[model samples]
Target: MTDLNQAIETLSHHEEGVFPRKALETLLDNQEAVNPQLLDYLESVAIDPTGTIESWQTDFLVVALFLLAQFRDVRAYQPLIKLLNKLDSETDWILGEEGLSRILASVCDGDVTPLQALAENPEIAEYIRSEAFYALLTLVCRGQWDKSALHDYCRRMLEGGLNYEGGYLRISLTHICEMMMFSDLLETIRNCYQKWPEMSEFIRFDEVEESLQSGEADEFGLSFHRDYITDAIADLEKHACFVAGDGAEGDDLDGFDLSELFGSPDDVASEVEGFFANAETQETFVRDLPKVGRNDPCPCGSGKKFKKCCGK
Candidate 1:
């Protein structure tokens, strides 16, 4: 067996030397038999600063935790909450946002008390603060908190300057708008947006009207429009750049156009329409979109598949 396989075998009791996918399937099938093992594995990894654990091991742990939550195993709450808090402190050491998000999705349904506690902590890290904001918005969207409470909480947090970092603050503000929209707290949302014009890109009136007409506000409510607007604004900002001028370092080139390189606007529109017109094309487009794959080269450009490189 390979050395990694041997290592997995030494750590786990399964016959195979590899972290078995069947283990996860089995755990999901029978929560009682696998929860203890899953909990032990999660605790070990939570304290593992060196990150010697394999990617499959982490994946299995996360899956098992999610299953635990799905099964309504209240015992999983404390450990999951503790991990969320520590993940903020050790963002670099952990498996990054994907792992954190998976954990959040698992435990978010049980009890939001942990999130509230984290928000109230004086030593909250920037990562934790951002996550708490996200969690609160999620709770609001899920109808766990009433509209008035959610609005007041978001307002208090923002006014308190808990999310003072530029990027974190911007994201928090965007999420606040999302929560307000979900709860139909439009007056409050508009107040906050008016107070911060920089947040205009994060809110969209057209999509809100569309959602209202379609009666599709049941899930994310009108906030889906705000997210779309923010995404479009972000895309525009990403492509905005200044090119070098004659002798000077550079000149601000606002309203620069690159339609020639991309053909006509009609051509661009057709390509986009074609992408959405066929299932195969849509699937291909989605697959090509930036994503992390276990078999693809590590994003760090380590020249190795994620499972065998940094993710290892």
Candidate 2:
């Protein structure tokens, strides 16, 4: 039986792309012992991001995150939420917005009060702030939160409860309503378009009507956590980037996409590094759009197609 610290150490410093499968399994097998230690380590890194990230040669941050997420320990909630608040949006490129949101949902253990507050907080980076909603929506879809309660909470959001600047919180809340098919809030939603004409530019008022009337879940909404499973080892090794030896970050198939997660391709860093690097750099407003046509004008007002712009 390897100690948790030993297991973590074994997983670290893999410049040669050597994954210690045995060490990771030790963690997975002893989640009750490992989860809190993982959170503590994450908090330590978060407390001194630059120093720690610069010091880390091992991908312990990524390992800890996936483990904590799958364990679904409520204890993991505050530390991850605190990091979400501290990291801001630039990390969006690092973890992929959906990826981070999945972690948030996984760790919340069905308690969404923190997520609601984060989603409604105007001062938080929109990318990070909006993640709370996506995570909450996932929990709702998973039946962790009552659909009626979610419906009511979304109604409150649309009815000026989200009354934050940047208009993103409101837009995000509306998307939640669409996902939940909360048709009861249609009039309230219509009022939003009238109150803020620019809202239509992000999502057409007509599409909202169509989606709500469909009597089915939006495909995008249905697809949130399909890959965020509970088996931590499988979660790690399923991705070739996380594998080691020749299968790891050698010549080709290389580490995961840095543009989607970290560095710049040749570099195989994880979102944990980027999240610790900066707390504010502005998340593009276009990130709030849902299932927008690639051919549509980029919502950021750049006039480029969505595919060519932020959607890319």
- The lDDT of each candidate is 0.46, 0.66
- The runs of at least 3 residues in candidate 2 whose Cα sits more than 4 Å from the true structure, single-residue gaps closed, are 1-23, 30-33, 50-58, 90-96, 195-202, 225-229, 233-312
RMSD of each: 15.9, 13.2
Candidate 1: what lDDT?
Answer: 0.46
TM-score (all chains, Cα) for each model: 0.48, 0.65
Error of 1 at 128 (Å): 4.2
With a 3 Å backbone cut-off (N, CA, C), the pairs that clash in candidate 2 are 13-58, 94-261
* Top lDDT model: 2
What digit string (tens of lDDT, one per residue) describes model 2 on residues 193-297? 788766676777888778788877566544643334477676566433354434333556556565664555435455655765664575645665455565443
* Local lDDT at 174 for model 1: 41
Worst 10 residues of 2 by lDDT: 89-98
Cα distance off (Å), candidate 2, residue 142 = 3.3
Local error of candidate 1 at residue 207 (angstroms): 10
